[model samples]
Target chain A: DAGITQSPRYKITETGRQVTLMCHQTWSHSYMFWYRQDLGHGLRLIYYSAAADITDKGEVPDGYVVSRSKTENFPLTLESATRSQTSVYFCARRTDYGYTFGSGTRLTVV
Target chain B: GIQVEQSPPDLILQEGANSTLRCNFSDSVNNLQWFHQNPWGQLINLFYIPSGTKQNGRLSATTVATERYSLLYISSSQTTDSGVYFCAAQTGANNLFFGTGTRLTVIP
Candidate 1:
């Protein structure tokens, strides 16, 4: 129960509704990242936080919002969900050696 | 930003066969990692070989940073090894850039 975990593993929302995916890691890793995996595009980074209150945009940050108020939590929110945002979202925490990813959240926008 | 490319985009192997997956990067990298995403969509860390070689069970990986490439070998593959393998790199950045990945299907 001490590893990274993502809530709402499976979600379905309307196109214009607001949705948020929660990611929590107990390791207290300094780096937390959010990535969206889409067909043919691989895993594209949406945002990353170096430390508490320090966040940066990644390759594909548009249509997505992220915040890191606590070192152990990095949540990604979609202000207005779209059909294109329907994909498996993954949250990862980076230690000195490597990264550990969550089981992933499968979000479907109708 | 560094570009990471993985070879043998798709592969099929028998349970007792051996296979190798390659990853090439466009620039020098300070960190390199190989991950196995199982059928259940869990990304498990296989190896964090920035340079040199390391092995675990039937899996092994080598990262030749000087050449900007890495190779992952799986021997006596099992049906459980059927999934996508991803190679990610960090070029002095805090975040890792992942490749398209190599999908390996092991038939028993």
Candidate 2:
């Protein structure tokens, strides 16, 4: 309850459908990030928010969108989910020392 | 963009053995971090070494910022330690570039 948390620990969606993954951090960190981990690729950042209403694209932001309406929330949305988007997604908050990641969301686009 | 490379893509060791994982970055970084991704897919921060050494329990890390490299040491490895170890370098812009990771397997 005191750390970052991602909703829908597991999700399955059909290709071309819209899906949204939610991330909430209780600490209200100024920086929040979304990263997708794939085999052989480690973790690739998809989007990041520096503060409320300020977001930027990361290494792999092609089909994803992000919004930070509040310091405690950063949600990632797949406007049109594709099979290639199937991967384990992690939400993290930049801490004083380093970044703290959530449990991860396993998403499968069929 | 920064490039992060990790050595020993795969490793197998017996329990109680000691191991070291290496990470190299292409450019200068403001800080370096080590994380352990457990089999359950949880990324736990191990160290936040910028240019010094720090230890926690059986794990220790050292980052030579001037050299653009970092090392993570795990002593007396256990089954629980069998996971993917990743090193991430943070730039001045606060973007973290992660290494491909070193997967370790420990057998009893």
Candidate 3:
């Protein structure tokens, strides 16, 4: 209840469908990030929000979208899911100590 | 962009054994941290050592900023320690670059 959390621990979607992954933190951290983990790629940032209404792209942000209307929530959306987008997604919040990550969401596209 | 590489892609250790994991960065790092991805896919932050050394229980980490490398030491390994260890680096940016990770298996 005190840390960040992700919704839909596992998901199966059809190609070309739209899907949204929700991330929420209780700390209201100023920075929140979205990353995807693929084999051999480790974890690459997709998008990040410095604060409410300020979102920026990271290394790989194509085909995905993010919004942070409030400090506690940063949701990532895949407009057209593809097989290549199938990977574990993670959400993180920047803390004074370090970045705090949420329980990842394992997504599959068929 | 900074590249973070980890050594010993995979490792297997007996319970009560010890192992060391290494992380190398391509550029000077402003921040360095280590994390453990558990079997349930939770990323648990273990250390945030940009320089010097820090210890917590059986886990300890040392970062030599001058060398651009860091090492994680785990003594008396346990079954619960079986997971993937990842080191991430930041080069004066808000984005953190992660290594491929070292998968460790501690068999009982």
Candidate 4:
């Protein structure tokens, strides 16, 4: 319960709606990441933040937006949800020991 | 960008058996991690062996940076170990590039 957590464990939304998935960590890690997992593909990074206000794109960042206003929080937003974006999204934070990952959020677009 | 490849895409073992999973990367990396994704979609970090060897309970990992590969050994496999195992690597402080993964099934 003290590690990383993702909100809205499962969500269903329309293709044109904007949906935001939340990620929170208690370790105050310097690096946080958002990744989406799809069939036949490994976890692909959508965005990552080094610290508050410092964010950058990853391998796949077309319709996703991420902001880290606080070291303990990194929220990912799907500007306009697409059926193609339906997958299990995971949030992870890097620490001295290793990476702590959230349980993941399953998002389905109609 | 570095490419991560995992061998034995799928593995099946009997309970109490032992297995080894391998991961090969295309370039050098600063961070290497192993994760187990359960049926519930939780990615549990198993090890952070960028180099050298480390062991925890029945699980152990070795990362040979010079060889650009890593190996994970699971001793006395259990039914609870059935799931997908992934290996990820990153150069510098960049985000990790995960391998396609190895799906493991442990039968009773």
Q: After best superposition, candidate 4 residue B41: deviation in angstroms? A: 1.1
Off by over 4 Å in 1: none
Docking class of 3: high
Q: Which stretches of candidate 2 lie over 4 Å from their true place?
A: none
CA shift at B31, candidate 2, in angstroms? 1.8
Q: Report the poorest 10 consecutive residues by lDDT, candidate 4 chain B.
A: B89-98
**Which model is ahead, 2 or 3, in terms of DockQ?**
3
Q: Which stretches of candidate 4 lie over 4 Å from their true place?
A: none
Candidate 2 residue B11 C-alpha distance from true site, Å: 1.1
Better of 2 and 4 by DockQ: 4
- lDDT pick, better of 3 and 4: 3
lDDT at A59, model 1:
90
Each prediction's whole-model lDDT (CA): 0.93, 0.92, 0.95, 0.92
Clashing pairs in 2: none
| Candidate 2 lDDT tens digits, B1-108 | 789999999999999999999999988888789999989989999898888999999999998888889999999999999999999998887578899999999999
- Measured against the true structure, the TM-scores of the candidates, in listed sequence, are 0.97, 0.97, 0.97, 0.97
The best-first sequence of candidates by DockQ reads 3, 4, 1, 2
lDDT of 2 by residue, A32-91 (tens): 999999987889889999999999988899999999989999999999999999999999
lDDT of 1: 0.93
What does candidate 4's lDDT look like per residue over B1-108, in tens digits? 789999899999999999999999998998999999888778888998999999999999999999999999999999999999999999975788899999999999
Measure candidate 1: CA RMSD: 1.1
Q: Tell me the interface RMSD of model 1, in angstroms.
A: 0.9
Root-mean-square deviation (CA) per prediction: 1.1, 1.1, 1.0, 1.1
